[model samples]
Target: METRRDLRGILFVLVVFVGLAVIWRDLRYDFNFASDMHKAELGRRRETITQTVTSIALQTQIETQTELTTEIVKLSEDVSPAEKA
Candidate 1:
């Protein structure tokens, strides 16, 4: 019974070590894969962000110009021809 208990303890420790090794290996691989993907996508992400910002800015400018033109037209209608002369 003592020998059997000693064998069980050794087996338990060995299994725990094997499990830890497997977990560490998987984590290392995942970290490396994610790092590589980020490096690959960095430029594409930057370009996409820049394009989106530029598009938003241009749309804002157009809307502002349209609003200003409408206001000018309204003001012109309120004024008389003599005001222009």
Candidate 2:
């Protein structure tokens, strides 16, 4: 029932379908790889943000402690003469 031309047409269609399938698979692989990379990058950014927040908190605490110490020394000086009398 098949002639040479019909057989050639079927072969061509099969080759095209296979090619398209391979292309689709490659695209899916690329999408998965890109998603994995983004997830890793996001995790690293979170870590960096946490470290930055901790550093800022420590600096603020150190500044507050220095301010308190200065106030205590000034108060002691003011009271020293009164106590002597």
| Model 1 weakest 10-residue run by lDDT | 39-48
Candidate lDDT values, in order: 0.61, 0.60
- Per-residue error at 33 for model 1, in Å? 12
Q: On a 0 to 1 TM-score scale, where does candidate 2 land against the true structure?
A: 0.53
Residue 34 in candidate 1, Cα distance off native in Å: 8.3
Off by over 4 Å in 2: 1-34, 81-85
User: Which residue runs of candidate 1 sit more than 4 Å off their true CA positions?
Assistant: 1-37
lDDT of 2 by residue, 1-85 (tens): 2364355456556655655555555456655764777656655654565565556556655665676688789888889676968
Q: What is the C-alpha RMSD of each candidate to the true structure, in Å?
A: 27.7, 30.7
